[model samples]
Target: MSDQYLVRIEGKNTDIAVEETQSILDAALRANEWLPHSCTQGTCGTCKLKVLRGEVDHRQTPEYTLTVEERAEGLALGCMATPRSDLTVEPLGNVSDDGVPRHPLRDYEGTVVVLDDIAANTRRLVIELDTPMQFNAGQYAELIVPEHAGARQYSMANPPTETRRLEFHIKLTAGGLSTDGWIFRSMTLGERVSLRGPLGQFNLVAKQDEPAILIGGGTGLAPLKSIVQHALVEDLVPELFLYHGGRRREDLYDVEFFRDLEHRHPHFHYRPVLSEEQWEGATGLVTDVVVSDFPSCKGMSAFLCGPPAMVDAAVKALKRRRMAPRLIFREEFAITPATSTAPAVL
Candidate 1:
């Protein structure tokens, strides 16, 4: 079987070899070029492109991630999408043949520092890198598990600092390999793991004076939390609202920490929405709560994270509220066969 294909990005004057099983974003990033992307898991539409030529198998792409019009226009997500032919595409945003920070991939060693529960289905993971590593907020790294052939990806929940301590919010999916195999119960302090990356194009792009909107579902809060703190510290946005959702009250963890952030910064606000349980705060889906707060997200840059469905619905809702498609950013924690599908046990 043909395992590779050529990709020519329009206006970029860049042509790179893309493997049949590799993501275009992966190839670009490996080549030291930044593409507008996040999640890199086929959930975020940031890597969306207009396919001028060639074909792709979007079977693994989430239905909620792209719109019908986008599909009709021959668009596809670069992360989960694989080239089926020699291809050419027009990238949407956050790109340039030159300009913007491009951190070349590097390898590092790290020891597990802390593994504590942060929510009902989530855990707070802290890793102490042997050497200081740099990465933009919202970027993730692959944690190589000894028992697995492939590395599992996790987003850093903290902004860049001089320290090597990185944080992550890991959700223990039912029958999850890493969760069940090591992360949840078996992993121990001082355990060493191979780390590579500072990967993905999910970094923040601060637009002056525009209010930033962030929404997260379940453990999807990882990168968004990173982005939020980074934005506030850098003064990236004058004001912002973060809406986090879960099935129950327990899922909306870290409420107090966020509330403290909001208290300290008048321009920043946090709202927790629960679907299954009633609360004094906003109820129903997170997207609905955001819409109810503002009829339209005009002049706002919206960042969404979580499962494919939540990210999709939020993106659509923001668009309907007159938010430009370009203004919305995302990362999908999709429940795909590769990640979330549990095997039948008899």
Candidate 2:
């Protein structure tokens, strides 16, 4: 029996070799075959596909995300399923050309230049890469956890122009393998780490005319920061509004950075909202504040990144305010189970 199996995509002239140890999605992306995916972990069901003709070992696929009935009905998560034999699969989501630039996946090694606590429970990590990585503004990279045999996904906070250095805002999770066990506790500056590049499809659309509203919660601000910087540099939008939400003032970081941008750019606006503590700026939920500011979002496009609850609420609020469904893009920060030693999404 061959250790590697050939997997063919339905209706596409694409066939890739998948090692028995590799996930189907990993191999597809390495072959430059774009597929819809968010968190590369098994948490998000975004990578769900139909296994048309072969067997797959659905390893580590969460039951909550991929139900037993779905598996029995020929459904599998491309991020978690490993080929048991030669396969034929069809991605559920459309992978048509949308004019967004897709950077090929590659491995890179980097030294940790800076690591500091930026917020209450979040830390700012900067890595100087050995080779430059080309990525879309909102795409993410996966860092291999030393000695853990797993990797955690973190969005680059810097713009794509800074290809030689990668910036990440990571929120520490209690007892997390990559967080508590490593980044927050044992990791040090000048240390080296391995990482993979330019993952995820949540990115800025090309040639968009409408003003953009970016909302972020906790460390979810990482990718939005990249987007805002890129947009301002390229003048991608007529106006840009950034709202970072936190439970208290201590939870918010980069206040001065955004304030400076707002001061310099007449079209840029920055709002920091505190939910648990009363602040001089906006209060209550971030989504509520946005709703109050924009009576109608009919002519605006929005990018939301945050916890699932917050993202879901923002989507609902924007939709009620008349924002078109297609104009709203979101990325939910999916935290892994505390007990499980699996790689998590930040």
Candidate 3:
């Protein structure tokens, strides 16, 4: 194997390791340095950085996402660009220095140990890692699929306490490459796989008694479930409202679990909204349910995961309720095009 190159951030004294196989964003994330990004893919362009000096391979990014003129101007999309050699890059913004020290980035070999159906089109995949990969409650991992040239990033539905064991909610979207091509139809037990991650910054804060409102759509419930479970175990959050939405009754599969949680915790509230179905509990989009329930969202923290549109809608609703912009955390399942140059909402 070849040696990884050193990447120096243009404006900061920080230096990060970059492998030719990994995107710059992923490398920076592994270093636990917060870089501005939405979806860790080329679609959003939130992670676009200026290549002050160095050679880069921007071919990983979709042609449409970055223009030739931009490339000529020494611009690169951090989520898609891989370092061709030693480089100096500039971040679009800065991150808080008050965060916890990040876990070291490491590669782990794993095999498929468990696969079970969770919802209408979702499956729970559990992989036993070769070594423990410590991650925050709401972070994600990019699994190295056997066939695809690019890996797909999925949020870990389990917390750090369950070290060495990674669980991901795999949603089968229409025309998805890995989900349909291999994972669902051909992947078998004991099949060897590789993963690198514990990526992203959407996580729980140390607010012991604050209300935690979580909104999820489709398969986006994975990380939120992890957060809720961690909070419950630590007895951190006193009040919680989890609003999950789907088209039909089958979309929201964890109602019983939330109901059970509500039974045990007086402050915990479960609101599963169905868009197409006329459910008696809550109807319409999950954002609508969130808005209707809390007309004024002051002094509350909200975590949202789902398609870009749903997450945006939830942010708008929460802001309307007077929820502080800083308190609203989000992880987007960016919808990719038919080419799937980027990973879709998972």
Candidate 4:
């Protein structure tokens, strides 16, 4: 059966429809509305809001982050909660001083359509959504695998225009939850799974004409790749230099894709770095490479996606080079199931 509801935010109203069983966050995101959130599995406080009127229920949530008093006071995390009746929600974004957008989290069921081993340790998986899901290219999704209470977050590897199909680059982690279903492993096509989001505030600023330095490490290359692809398609060709790093050559999955991008777009430059080996390519930590290659980012903006360590390192290096904190946009990819916990405060 289907459920319908009216969501009122900031004097604007939107009609949202959802499957009777889906969460409000899933439905709202499916409709293509911006929502502030991170770690859609209830870990990031970005989607929290006040229920001005009406009732809701969160089927899967980390209640530890919220006090019983808070829930009783009408506080809820939209990504974890589902509307049970017509609702008037004071979207988290509307009351924020930072201007971050709080969008509804939408749900989708996608079938694993293809899986390709792009590198020795990284595999690319393609899922075809039952219906098209619109989102900015760099946004991510929380994939819920059956039999596991936890969710895994991953960024899309394809351009937004390719709505029905979503691509992801997965790196095998020692104890990763989704590692059991690796694209290069025994997982088969046609297996269906549930997903939530289009979560994240990382996207291109429409009017910003600053040259962008794109930094990615390991499978973190997924979102950066999508952003670059979308940037090209949208004709926002600010001088771009993409630097991707890995421990060895095999970790740089889809390496050829970036090479082709540089060839196709004259304004693009590609740098692939391997730290543990001598392959005659750029050699050093990715951040160090950026420091030695483009030391001063005085008038440039930087975008980064990777492990927390890499993200932190890149941010520090950029700061030393005179890049503003506001000029650096980033998305840190969370891989383990347990890492998808919501924050106490957004």
TM-score to native of every candidate shown: 0.77, 0.95, 0.88, 0.78
Q: What is the full ranking by TM-score, best candidate first?
A: 2, 3, 4, 1
Model 1 residue 202 CA deviation in Å = 2.0
Q: What TM-score does candidate 3 get on C-alpha atoms?
A: 0.88
lDDT of each: 0.78, 0.90, 0.79, 0.75
Identify the leading candidate in terms of TM-score.
2
Pairs that collide in candidate 2 are none
True-structure lDDT of candidate 3: 0.79
RMSD of candidate 4 to the truth, in angstroms, is 4.9
The worst-scoring run of ten residues by lDDT in candidate 3 lies at 337-346
Candidate 1 lowest-lDDT run of ten:
337-346
Q: How well does candidate 1 score on lDDT at residue 52? A: 95
Residues 36-126, candidate 2, lDDT per residue (tens digit)? 8888888888999999999999878889989999999999988888899999999998888888888877889999999999999899999
Positional deviation of 83 in candidate 1, in angstroms? 12
Off by over 4 Å in 1: 1-31, 35-94, 97-99, 339-346
Model 2 spans > 4 angstroms off: 338-346
Which regions of candidate 3 deviate over 4 angstroms? 1-5, 11-22, 29-38, 63-73, 208-210, 337-346
| Candidate closer to the true structure by TM-score (higher is better), 1 or 3 | 3
lDDT rank order = 2, 3, 1, 4
Per-residue lDDT of 4-112 in model 3, one digit per residue for the tens?
A: 8789987668888887766787777767666776567677677888999889987557767778998999888887788899999987645546454466556678989
